[model samples]
Target: MKNRPFRERMGFALEGIRTGWRREASFRTQTMLAGCALLALLVLRPAPIWWGLVAVTCALVLALELLNSAMEAVIDLLHPGIHPSIKIAKDMLAGAVLTISAAALVVGVAMVVATGPAFLAEIGL
Candidate 1:
């Protein structure tokens, strides 16, 4: 890849996000869920290591979603007509996203369990 200025690179990345938001429902859903997780983290004020794990896991899930979107776009462009190989490739890309998403779900649950009691008590639960 050509080394470009930071601002220019950010513009391209932002465009990708815009496209994904418009084209991929799953992307939007995952982003919303991640946002909620971050909000919970802010409320809980978890340990630094927990924050690191949440950040990394969220990033990984989002990155894999972007990759899956990119792959689907390319596959459709190259083979609009049905083919078994293309189907397999698309399925595998989706599977990768699903696997990462499942891992993120586990991390999210752990975070809630670790902090839920304190948060609930603060709310007079």
Candidate 2:
């Protein structure tokens, strides 16, 4: 197939986002969590390295989720009925998501703890 123009490519990407946001609760929830993390980062304004770690962790979680969603869709299309191998594949993908999410949680918590009293003060709590 011929390569599409940049605008068309972006439109297709946006459509994917719209479809995922509408169809996948996990996607929507993760997106909200990421947004909150970003807001926290802005408020905390930690060291430069911490910013990079947090950004990468958030991106990794979101990207893994999109891949998992795509995998589930393809698997369902190919195997509508239950099958052991299909179940394993889906389970592994979910496991990968869980692993990354846990990593992201760790990064987020570490940042919060490292910020310590300043974080609490920043929130005026």
Candidate lDDT (C-alpha), each: 0.91, 0.91
25-79 in candidate 1: lDDT tens per residue?
9899999989988997898887888899999999999889998999999999989
List residue ranges in candidate 2 displaced over 4 A.
120-125
* Clash tally, candidates in order: 0, 0
For every model shown, what is its TM-score relative to the native structure?
0.88, 0.88
lDDT for position 112 in model 2: 87
Shift in Å, residue 5, candidate 2: 1.8
The digit string of per-residue lDDT tens for model 2 on 11-102 reads 98888878888889999999999999999888888888888999999889888998899899999998999999999999999999999999
